[model samples]
Target: MQYLVLASRCLIGVVFLASVSTKVAGPAAFAAFVRSVRRMLLVPSGLVKPVAGVVVAAEAAIVVLLAVPTRATAVAGFAVATGLLLAFAGAITVTVRRGTRTTCRCFGASTVPLGPAHVLRNLLLVAVAVAGGVAAPTGGSLRLGESLVAAVAGLVLGGLVTVMDDIRALFHPTPASRRH
Candidate 1:
């Protein structure tokens, strides 16, 4: 159970760190993310940049909180992660239902349009956050070998999640194929 909780925390932290890093990589990257935010949500153009900033700040906070070696902070981190995932899922659902096909700038620039896959991914992350929160131990220690295994698993999972859109593209038909 402790290993599971640790892995979950690491996974969430890695995901958020990747997300924030991609968005803030450069001015153009950040701008693209803000544009995506504007397209996905119903916010006015003037508010889009600020909204993007808030999102990045929240993600950074999650990484920091999860890094703290305490059960309470871990729970808080999971709670924030879950809330953010739910919010993202809700926004993606609404955008998809509206027939919007803007590319999701979620991990930096990507051609994958906001769709059910994005929402599904977020919901799965939400489940992980919930499970981590519930299973967080008050205090514990792991053998060096066990810790390494859990850490590696978490990192691998997080990397997979960050590249989900690219993986989906391998199976999803191209625009030209759709016309056939």
Candidate 2:
């Protein structure tokens, strides 16, 4: 159980880090993607850039906050994950309503379309965060090796998933064909 909790924390931390890094690495592209999604929902165009900045900052903060050795880490992770899930859900709804099948852009330049799979991924992360919050662990002792290993594994997992999106896009091409 303790191992599971630790693994969950690592996974959540890695996921947040990867997600934020992608956005930070390509602010213009992320902003453009945000604008595309916003336009689909008929949101005021003026708010797009600001909203994109806020989202990127929030995600980065969540990753940093979760890495801290404090009780607040779990809470912050939970809040971040919940907020992310809600945001993605809203985006999915808007995209579906507008009938605009654009790439999700969740992982930088990935061609994975915004769909139920994306929503489910966010929801699963939310669940992991919530579980971590409920089982918040003390960070008194320094298990540097173990912790480092977990963090690295988490990051690798995130990278693999992001790459998988690209691989699927390459082989499958269109979103509709990939879906079936």
Candidate 3:
């Protein structure tokens, strides 16, 4: 049970950290991704940049809050995850209604488009966050060994996901026929 809870927490922490790192590392790319979604949604052009900034900042804060060792951190993480999922659901609904094909800006500059997959992903994250919040860990202080291992695992997972695009491209080189 302890290991299960620890695993869940680590997964959520990794996900949140990855999501934010993408935006923080490439603000301009993230901003462009957001702008594309806004255009697809027909959002007012003036509001695009501000909205992107707010989203990026919120994601970063959520990652930091979730990574820290505190009881309240789980609650805070759940709230943020829930809010993001709801917002994503709304956006996906609108995109479907408007017959717009737009990429989900959730992961910053990924080429993956906004679709049912994105909605499902958020829903899954929401579930994980809720579970972690409810089962907030309580124990004697973490030994330095445990803390170090958890932190390293979280960072490695986050870093891998953050560079998923590059990683994929490296393994699956484009065919010459498709490269024009």
Tens-place lDDT per residue, model 3, 1-180, is 233335456766677666766666765767666677576655677887777677767777777777676767756866786687567677787786777866555555555445665566667766766776666655445566776676566456545644554565576655321211
Candidate 2 global Cα RMSD = 3.8
lDDT of 3 at 82: 67
Question: How many clashes (backbone N, Cα, C below 3 Å) per candidate?
Answer: 0, 0, 1
The worst-scoring run of ten residues by lDDT in candidate 1 lies at: 171-180
Q: Between candidates 1 and 3, which one is better according to TM-score?
A: 1
Winner by lDDT: 1
Best by TM-score: 1
- In candidate 1 the C-alpha lDDT for residue 72 amounts to 91
Off by over 4 Å in 3: 1-5, 137-180
By lDDT, the candidates rank as: 1, 2, 3
**Candidate 2 vs 3: which has more TM-score:** 2
Q: Estimate each model's TM-score.
A: 0.92, 0.76, 0.71
For each candidate in the order shown, give its overall lDDT on alpha carbons.
Answer: 0.86, 0.67, 0.63
For model 1, what is the C-alpha lDDT against the true structure? 0.86
Candidate 1, 117: how far from true, in Å?
0.6
